[model samples]
Target: MLIDAIRIYCQKNGIQLSTRDKTLAADFFEHPHDYISDDYFNYKLHSFICRSHAELPEIFIVEEKGNDFLVYERIISDFCCLSQHKQQAPQSFIGKKIIILREQPKTLEAEALYATIKKRISGANLFFLPLVAFSLLLPFYSNLFNSRLVYSSSLTSVLYITIFFIFFALLEAFLKTSVYKTVVRATHDNSIKISKLLMYILTITSDDSAPSTTRAIELSSVSYWKAISSLMVDVALLLVFLICIVLLLGEYSIILFLYYLGFAIFCVYARFQSYESSLKSIAINNDRLIDSISLHNNRQQVRFTNFDTLRHAFYVKSLASEKLSHQLDLHNNRWAEILKLNTFISMVLMYIACYLAINTGSLSIATIIAVMIINSRLSAAMIASVNGCYSVKVNLHQIKASLTKLTQHIVLANANQLHLDKIEQLTLENITIEPHGHATLAGYNANFTRGNVVGVVGKVGVGKSTLLRAIIAQAALPHGAIRYNQVNIHNIDALTFQRQIAYYQPALQFFKGTLRFNFNLYGIHDTGRILAIIKYCCPAMTVDINILDDVDADALNFSAGERQKIIISMLLEKQPSLIILDEPTSFMSDDEGLDFLRHLIAQHHDAIFIIASHNADVNRIATTLINISNTGKHKKIFINTPRPTVPITVKPQGGLAE
Candidate 1:
């Protein structure tokens, strides 16, 4: 009820209230007059709407009091640029109707995406608070060594020290295990979350917006997590105690500790230098390997076919690999340097501090021996901290960069039970789809209505599959546009828009399972429908064996035509509004395929069919035929079969356009 009222308010004013805009609108509606003049809040709301809805091909004119003139006024000064690309910004606000889109409230950030995991991880680490307190009490337990302190007997003091040592050790073990496990879980969890989110952002949109740095960041995030999770608080507490006691011994001990720490920091920085180089090298090699696989697949191509080109490519790859190996070796050398240098430096520094203390009568021999033991542990902790910093540095930079990009495209579709409205007509206007800078299909204009089966006939590489992909809003259309029910696909809720249509490619990989297991794709068990489809399609060809068996052999026993029937049966069973099949029965004969196609088209008159096939028989059984050409040539269609005379209408099923 609140969303409907808000939607009415938005429609009256020409604002496109997107998936995240409803929350801001509601906040604004609380005190409408106050928010109208509240410049900062209005600015934030405007920015959010613009960013989240940037994927859509519409500009928003948020009619607020402050900065209305400056909102859509991004000036493109180049006259030639403006003329060639007429769709350039606020100037082309001609005959376009503005509809305000509204959606459920959602958090718009990378951190917001992982908010639940982060909160749980943070809460779990709260148990480490007692560890810090325990570290503070460590000195009290070690105080039995103080000769000046009066005790009943030396044996009694030894017993007290041993009992306390055992207690703290057990406590330390418990705290360490808890922290370590939490750290590892957090690392892996962060890795998986970032990998999926980053890949999603890359795969869905085609703006070349995702950077290589974003990939590098998510790739090695787990290692960085592991490195940082090691607890250093207890080690820090020990250092603090050592410093306090040594200060009483002599100031020279303090100087020695500071010197040792400075050297460790330098070693850590140098170690990180090698790590940074190695990371880049590893990433580059991985990219090259993927590229090489593609190159090998297309080895017969003009450039790749040349012997010289092949040799040069291999030479370049090998050269890069050599450099990577060299960097890795350098990293190893630096690690060894730190290990040996720290130990040698620790001994020297301890010797000098002790020598100075004894010569100046600042501390007794027994106190110096205790200080020696403390120095070793202190040095070890410093080295561990150094290593931890190196690992964190590599991952933290990329994580922040990825977060920044994800924050920009924050479309969160978390609503359950989304219903799709019936699409009356799907239209494409001058849609030219060219992948990888090569022209495939050009100027594809058509209208698809329910009950009308449009057969797309084209030669190989004529962009039939590309056109199918573009129609379903799967590929980004930079040249032309597509609309469903006269509304641009991008203007609708992305999740709901996707639900209305289904595209089935010819190269389908069916899971090796029983016919019953494979057919129930939506996890909806309908044994009766499966049996009926088999009976209608393949009644005569009866195998005198059981098909209900849930074995891999039973599923793979079906012939190519039989498998196609099964796939078609499964897709048709789902009853999607629009179905685009790219050569669904390429392996089957044209006559046999026509029988199935005709039956499917006639049976499901409510759903529109767009089949791309080479069969001429398809044209006779379809309402409209699309003959594709790459050189901007169009062919006439021979449509013999008339479509059902069903009136079409666009119904609203959600707050925004479906």
Candidate 2:
């Protein structure tokens, strides 16, 4: 349990591990963090012992029928040390046993994300609203001119309106540039916010035991872009719509104004109904295909369901969508009937008003013609604006739903400032990881104080990747502690902690962007570093390493090996303190993989590395190798000793490192 680990950690630190400290530990476990100082976690020990893997004693916790239930190195407190996990446990594992010597995690808020979008959209409206007001007033020039053409007065009025339009056009041009920049900036800012949430979600939901599957969290990769893309257009149209309404009432009759409002409402409502049906259709179809696509992307060859089966399933979903569309269309058609009634009422009102004016000799045929033209133009603008507003509202509501779904599962970085500048060491103490309640790895004990290449070797299905994820995240322990420096990782902010650690798994994807974009993610802009990475990854290409103009050559187009190399190169450029690779070089050629590692080891000798691979040759490079067993037991082997080596083939028949 984390309370036990804390007592041990406190014992080593010589801090008074009081009974109140136990209460603090319990509270910290439930909350994960409770605002402790970084210095409180300093794990600098006074004494340590080094021994061969075989010489180390295995400490068993429980036994059944004389079988080992849990086994690891004994807690020789005077010399005990543990590896560090740099972040907090997932939101799902709130009460699980793990060292969480920090403050409680706060809920991620969608309001913060929406506020950024709102600020930008509001700024754009400042420029657009005034232009729309002037455009709406353009049709009311009849009020300025004489009813019958006084030639001089009419010409003057026409010239005055033209100059007014030209003046507003100039203002529009001035604001357009600023508005465009603001929109782009806001979209980019929103992308960063969504990206943060995506990462947080991935961290919590990486394990099967997670409350939900977030591996290919559909929201992370695509939704924000869709939400932000059409926002400005909607805002502009809405401004124009409102301005048109005001102008209608000012230039025409109350009846005409009412007619315009009613027509615009019906038009927007009908369009919104159809738009809603399409949204439902899209959502249904996405649900139908998402699992198959996710499985295919994961590179799993196992056939769960057949192609014809998928086809039939999609057919069923499509039928539902079609039915939904039909229902919406029926409702719209009914509204269309109401619109006909509205048009009849408007026509009758127009005739009465026009008849009264004509009889009073106040309106001429020319003036009536002029009024009709203005009404026609005014209705089009009003309808356009209303439809735009409705579209944006629907999109925003959908996006907010997605955000809410994700925020519930993960705890994001707190508003309170935190930073993990570097990863100096890692410590793990008697940690048992039973993912989905299947005890794949148990009683794993290791002290990696001086960061070095650490490897886990085991047979197929013996939880090598599972253990690696335990250290690298995606899998949280049920008991014990994984601390970095001295602070429980569960107390540290996930994103801040992640900044100091680089994790690469084969299933991860890169963005569809330029070479510079991939490399520039860590805010490192060293030209030499980028050139070195590009030269190693893609030697055959003649493209400029830094400013590769091929923007379209993103993740989809790149080969598997190419994508892997690009990600590795990005990690190398950033030079994080801890580098974790789970089959990272699996896609690369043997020679290519070796060459990349040679460069990596040379540059990043100080960083801690946890590499899990099937290749025996890969494990031979590690300073210490831990052999994982099928019964969730571990055996340590010191490979870097001075002894004559005899090669033996290690197969996947049983859980052994050989």
TM-score per candidate, in order?
0.64, 0.55
Model 2, residue 631: displacement in angstroms? 3.4
Predicted model with the maximum lDDT = 1
Per-residue lDDT, model 1, residue 95, is: 38
lDDT of every model, 2 decimals: 0.59, 0.55
Cα-lDDT of candidate 2: 0.55
Candidate 1: which stretches are off by over 4 Å? 1-157, 175-219, 231-242, 245-248, 288-323, 397-419, 429-446, 478-481, 494-499, 511-523, 527-563, 631-658
lDDT tens per residue, model 1, 107-225: 43556543332232324544555565555344444443554334446677677767777788788888878776876665554555455446656544332435454565565465554
Candidate 2, residue 218: Cα displacement in angstroms equals 14
Worst 10 residues of 2 by lDDT: 45-54
Q: What is the lDDT of candidate 1?
A: 0.59
